[model samples]
Target: MRAWLFSGLLVLLVGCATPAPDSLYQQLGGQTGITRIVEDMLLRAAADARIKQHFVEVDIVRVRDKLVEQLCELSGGPCIYSGDSMEESHTGLHISRSDFNALVELLQAAMDQQGVSVRAQNQLLAHLAPMRGEIIER
Candidate 1:
């Protein structure tokens, strides 16, 4: 009886063990990983005909900087985003569902290229999903 109790207690303790710390930033390889993902995504977006027109008159460099900053902050990194709010920035753009989907595809491809795990990719996407209302006008 004592042996069975000891085994049960051991199993319980093991079951209660804490999970490893897994912040989105750390899972994404921190600042360097984020920058690489952002750059790759931007390149893809710029090359895609479906969304390239949106950036025709925009400053690509500033956009990249803001993206990196925003992504970093969103992923629980040590960076702070000082850019405009999502709604304010995307206002008047009249972005449609297709446009948003294209950008998300580009981002997913970029994350895959950077070897970001699918779990982390999904985690990031989940966090960004709520911003759709702020970004999409149609």
Candidate 2:
């Protein structure tokens, strides 16, 4: 009887054990992966006529770094975003809704190129979607 009870308890404990879920950071391949995504997005943006002008005089390297930081933090990674608020940074740029949408498309393409899963890409985009109001038409 004692042995049977011990076996049953062990089985119950094992059944209750579950692996932790992956954080968004892990789904995004962590820091190195996010860096690659940001770099790819920036390169594409620079060539896109509809939005390239916005980046003409900007510091590309700094923009890449800040984007990486922001993405990392938003995705539950270890980096913190040290850049200005979206509104503050875009205030003078007079961005339009189409411009914002184009940039989002660029980012989605970048993520696709990086082989990110569709669910992960959508999750990241959903997190960023709220910022559109802060970025367009200052």
Candidate 3:
């Protein structure tokens, strides 16, 4: 009877224990990984004719820093996004759907280059999808 009771207690304890799963931020490899992804995307964008013009006049370093912060926060990391609102920053940029799509593709390429899992990439894209309306003025 004591053996059975002990087994039951052990089972109960095990069942009630909660294991902490890794957050998306951790899956994205924390701040350093996010920084790498952002930098890679920016570099690709700079050379890609489809979106390069949009970045011609902007401060690339500031954009990179803000993108890193934004992605970090979006993925549940410790960083906070201190950049301007999507609409506020994108206003008057005349960004079209094609331009936005090109940027997204560049970002995806960057993530792929970093070996980020597709699941994590989709999750991050899902989080950012809502902001498309705010970013595309045309």
Error of 3 at 18 (Å): 17
- Alpha carbon lDDT of each predicted model: 0.88, 0.89, 0.90
Q: Give the TM-score of candidate 3.
A: 0.84
- Segments of candidate 3 deviating more than 4 angstroms: 1-21
Q: lDDT, candidate 3, residue 36?
A: 93
How far in Å is the alpha carbon of 125 misplaced in model 1?
0.6
**Candidate 2: regions farther than 4 A off:** 1-21
Output the number of the lDDT-best candidate. Answer: 3
RMSD of each: 8.4, 7.2, 7.3
lDDT of 2 by residue, 1-138 (tens): 999999999988765442124878778878888999999999999999999999999999999999999998898777879999999889989899999999999999999998999999999999999999999994
8-124, model 1: which lDDT tens digit per residue? Answer: 999887654422248888788788889899999999988999998898888899999999888888887767899999899999998999999999999999999999999999999
Ordered by TM-score, highest first, the candidates read 3, 2, 1
Error of 2 at 120 (Å): 0.5
Number of the top candidate by TM-score? Answer: 3
- Model 2, residue 123: displacement in angstroms? 0.6
Compose the digit string of candidate 3's lDDT tens values, residues 1-138: 999999999988865442224777877778888999999999999999999999999999999999999998888877789999999989999999999999999999999999999999999999999999999996
**Deviation (Å) of 116 in candidate 3:** 0.3
